[model samples]
Target: MDTHSRSFAKALSWRATGTIDTMIISLVITGSIKLAAAIGATEVVTKSLLYYLHERAWLKIPYGRKTAS
Candidate 1:
């Protein structure tokens, strides 16, 4: 089983990559660094929480997991 801290750490690292991608897309569409940054900042918080929850939820499922005897 994965611990809460491990989930949180994974969330943070994934968010960093996702945030950068979001900022780049936002900048291209809006042509504004400020707006892109704001979008990225908001995404970091919201998506991180969502991702952490999603990860934890998946851990509860038994599908596709192998167990040692």
Candidate 2:
């Protein structure tokens, strides 16, 4: 493992059990639940884009080398 990977893993860990992640999850869940109501519109497009962006943004974080600590 390298520094970049470590940092990325750290970022994911942070996102997994925090306020930011909770909000993201909630948003996605709600959007999916409401998809039927919004058929074909900006809402679906925006939700799709947001999900992609969120994944890509997290991918940018660097995972680092392992440490004794």
Top candidate on TM-score is: 1
lDDT of 1 at 14: 98
lDDT of candidate 1 at residue 4, scale 0 to 100? 100
* lDDT digits (tens) for residues 1-69 of candidate 2: 235556556544553344344455555777663553343344444554555556566566656635578
- Candidate 1 per-residue C-alpha lDDT over 1-69 given as tens digits, one digit per residue, 9 for 90 to 100: 999999999999999999999999999999999999999999999999999999999999999999998
Please give the CA lDDT of all the candidate structures. 0.99, 0.51
Model 2 poorest 10 in a row by lDDT: 36-45
Q: State how far residue 14 of model 1 sits from its true place (Å).
A: 0.3
Model 2's C-alpha root-mean-square deviation from the true structure amounts to: 9.3
